[model samples]
Target chain A: MPSLLHHPLDPASRIARLMLAEYGVPVDLEEIKPWLREAEFLEVNPAATVPVLIEGDVIVAIGPLASIHAIEDSYSPEAVAGLFPTDAAERAEMWRLFEWVAVKFNDEVTRYFIEEKIAKRDQRGSTPDTGVLRAAKANLHEHILYFNWLAATRRWLGGDTMSLADFALAAHISTLDYLGDIDWGTAADMRDWYSRIKSRPAFRTLLNDRVIALPPQKGYADLDF
Target chain B: MPSLLHHPLDPASRIARLMLAEYGVPVDLEEIKPWLREAEFLEVNPAATVPVLIEGDVIVAIGPLASIHAIEDSYSPEAVAGLFPTDAAERAEMWRLFEWVAVKFNDEVTRYFIEEKIAKRDQRGSTPDTGVLRAAKANLHEHILYFNWLAATRRWLGGDTMSLADFALAAHISTLDYLGDIDWGTAADMRDWYSRIKSRPAFRTLLNDRVIALPPQKGYADLDF
Candidate 1:
């Protein structure tokens, strides 16, 4: 059985979980605060980041990007063809959108919203700085608008067929939505897209994720919303 | 023919350039400062990132990771079998090391060093902040130690066969070396590994790169060093 070391709210961890679920691969999940840098966890991933997937002897995939790729590499394309496109051009676009979410979206929104807004308040018991949250919200609007453009134009984030890009974007958006950081009313196209993905059986694990002291927003777990 | 928008010192751009050369794929390189965020370049990649590869009509690979993946996707595996491993396990490791250099190393060392010590100086005529450069150097030393361990153990960074990990790593180290930021004396094993890769025909173009206003260090182009 594969095991995943991850954090509940981490978008990267969410990406791994979504991939595993989408591929119908079951894995044991162990939550770890990588910032704590536990000695045991450090042995798994020296970088002390989450979503480290350990499968079989001598097979460990560290970091978010690696973990996701590891899953894709292992699964037969026939079993999970939706995650990776078959056409060369589509594959390139899939990778592009994947990076857009992983690197660009992460830097612009996740670092500010999750790291500063949510993590700080949850872990450190610190007050969320309005200035940082404000900037992240502003960035989120632009990202949401761009995502809306992608959604409105295409059937999926990456292309006509769903791919890792959809999961990546949903992973980030899910976290923000859980924090009540998104204005869904203003994001009709995004809302429609998220609703479709949110209703998937693979998303059940994510929707069920709950932080004891910090509960999710009202519609976070609602399928219709 | 492919066209690559790259910046000489940018590690991501260097990775793209190296991958293209290693694969024997020639690309017309047009240096672009992403920070300028030119409208034309923004159309190529809205993120305003370098290393955008446009190959024929309707095939555009944005960002470094995508550009590399694009080349791998388009070309026959036999043509450039070294870039991506055939075995699933080896491929996973290959990607792990690739991400290690792209995301982790770039964030910890390259971003600080390039942004503070190089880009800021080049763009704003600002003096390099010694404190930031000092911190980046310290981070680089730790990274070098890790790379040395990898080189001492494995025949290549990914495994016995040279992989994209080697190129990704060399891409960053080459830039830092050009800046004279690395203390090669403390990195004997890493130096041995780098020299082998540095001597490749593909690396010649990178070595020959000259920014007239910002010349490289004395030993930058010297493989014997």
Candidate 2:
């Protein structure tokens, strides 16, 4: 089994965990408080980001891309079915959607939330400004609308197959959902897509993740949600 | 010829331009001002980021990954020798550095410059905050320090060979260098690596780039610098 240094609240870490579970790759999870500024953690990733994986002598640190690459390399195709499309075009599509969520959505949503809930607390700052939160909320709605369009057109964000893109996106959305930031009523197609992804066995660990007093939304664990 | 929708000042776009030049791929470059909030540009990328590429019917949007993927798909290997290593491990290492420069460094440094120079000017009410600028300048020192460490250990950031990582990183550093932010005296090895990259044929266009009023550093165009 490999070892994973991660933060429970981190969407990127959750995405990696989901990938590992999806591939049936057991990993020893070590919770890393990125805010604490640990020297050991910094040595693994000078960027101080989460989802760092240690496999034997190799240390792969980054976000979903690193985890996805690791999973692809370590597992047989059959083990992680539908996680990564093998076809060239499909693989490109998968990468496109993954990038969409990882970069765009993460930039618009997760960064704000983490800074507000975690960083602010550590720094003993006043609560996050409503102006920023309002902007993020609006941006997230637009992102959901885009997802609605993609879900309505393609069976999954990437294409007809459920790939790592779906998991990568859902991981972020789920984290927001835990914070009660997502307005699922904005898009039916997106909601349906989320429902499908949320119910997967791979998502169980993520859904069960408890972030102290930040209890999930009422229907966060509901499969039918 | 492939079409590239980009803004010259955008580091990611410049990196793509360098890659295209290095690969000898003919690309029709179209200047895109993302700040203009054009509908068509938004359609291609809702985030309104630059460096989006149009290859036939497929729209490859985003930064280094998309640019690299496009180059890998379209270009001949011999034209850009060793720019994108084909070996899986070597390629992964290349991507790691590419991601660092394109995303991490860009976010930490370039975005602040844009915010100060352009974004503040456009949104006149939001004056350029000296505090943010100071932080960006301070943060850059740490980044340069890390680069120095990498330069001391490896021939290139990726390894023994010059790879996409070099181009991706140099593209941003060159932009910062143009702004006179880099302290070359701090890292002689890093400076030497950069001088070699800066002298490459692919870097000619970058050397010629002129941002009004914010002139390049005194030695920006000098290969011997």
Candidate 3:
């Protein structure tokens, strides 16, 4: 069995887990406490980032693209619920949206939340900074607006089919929602899109995720907000 | 003719430019001063990022990966060049390294340089913080050491061939070198590797890059540095 080095709260890790679950691939989840600076974890990913996949002797480390590439190359079913688009133009669009979330959204929101909340708490006595959080919250609002525009125009972020782009974005947004950072009332189309995504069987595992003392927002597990 | 929305000094933009020149593709470069808040450019990329490629009606924006993917898929020669490895595992490794430099290195080092230098200069009367510059310089030294380790172990960052990994790294290093931020003396192996990359025909345009009042370092054009 492949061993996935990850943290439950990490969006990238969550996305990887969702992909594995979607594919019906069993993987051993080894939680990595990045703050602990574990040497073994560092060996797998020299950069010491999470969501490192260890498959026998070959170790695949990096973000969504690398993980998605590895999983798709090895286990993607012919036509049943694949995460990537088969058509050339659609595939390109899928990649674009995947990158938009992985880089832009991740940078503008997820990393800020981690750095401000988790990393701050881990480094004891340090509290999350209001300034950084303020910037992140503002940026997130703009990001949601962009998502609203996309969700309003297209069937999905990429196109007609569900792709890695949706999972990548939902992973980040879900994590933020866990912290009550998301304002679902802002975009009706996005709210409807989230409603559909939240109902996915693969997302159930994510809905149950808890971070001790930081219980998810009241309606986190509910299908309807 | 294709239009490229870019900031010439941006490492990612520079890399895209190099890749286009290397492939003999002609592009009309349009400078988008990100700080200027140009609505027209922002329409092309909501993220307000550079190196956006406009091919006919299709607007492909974001980082080097999107541009690289577009170039490889559309214009690459029948015989795959050493720039992007043909082997699956090797290609994955190259992509991983590319991500490291494009995202990690760019965030850690390049952003600091931009925040300290250009942004500060643009906001006249606001001096570049010496402390931030010092920290960025220190952090950059550590990054070079890591690069030295890679140079010592592999023929190229992705191993045995010049790949996108090399270009990704060189792109950032060249940008820093232009501002005299890199201390090439820190790693001989890294310097040697860079010397080879600098001599490539793809690199000539980068060497001639001028960023207004910030002339490149003395050795920027010297092939034997």
Two-way lDDT contest, 1 vs 2, winner: 1
Positional deviation of residue B53's Cα in model 3 after best superposition, in angstroms: 1.2
Please list the residue runs of candidate 1 whose C-alpha ends up more than 4 Å from where it truly belongs after superposition.
A56-58, A77-80, A121-125, B76-80, B121-125
Kindly give the stretch of ten consecutive residues in candidate 1 chain B with the minimal lDDT sum: B73-82
TM-score ranking, best first:
1, 3, 2
- Judge candidate 1 at residue B151 and give its lDDT: 94
Q: List the residue pairs that clash in candidate 3.
A: none
Q: Which scores higher on TM-score, 1 or 3?
A: 1
Highest TM-score against the true fold, candidate: 1
TM-score of each: 0.94, 0.89, 0.92
Clashes of each: 0, 0, 0
DockQ, each predicted model: 0.64, 0.29, 0.35
Q: For model 1, how does the per-residue alpha-carbon lDDT over A91-184 read when each residue is reduced to its tens digit?
A: 7788888888998888888878777755676465578788988988899889899999989999998778988889999999999889999899
In candidate 1, what are the lDDT values of residues B1-225, reduced to their tens digit?
Answer: 888889999988998888778778888888898877889878878878778887665547888767887777775357446688887777778888888889889988998887876678656557888898888888888888899999999889988999889999999999988888889898888899999999999999899998767889989999898
Pairs that collide in candidate 2 are none
- Which number leads on DockQ? 1
Which is superior by DockQ, 2 or 3?
A: 3
- The ten-residue window of minimal lDDT in model 2 chain A covers A60-69
What lDDT tens digits, residue by residue, belong to model 2 across residues B56-143?
Answer: 8777545445555656666747544657676667766776677777778877888898778665666748787899989998888888
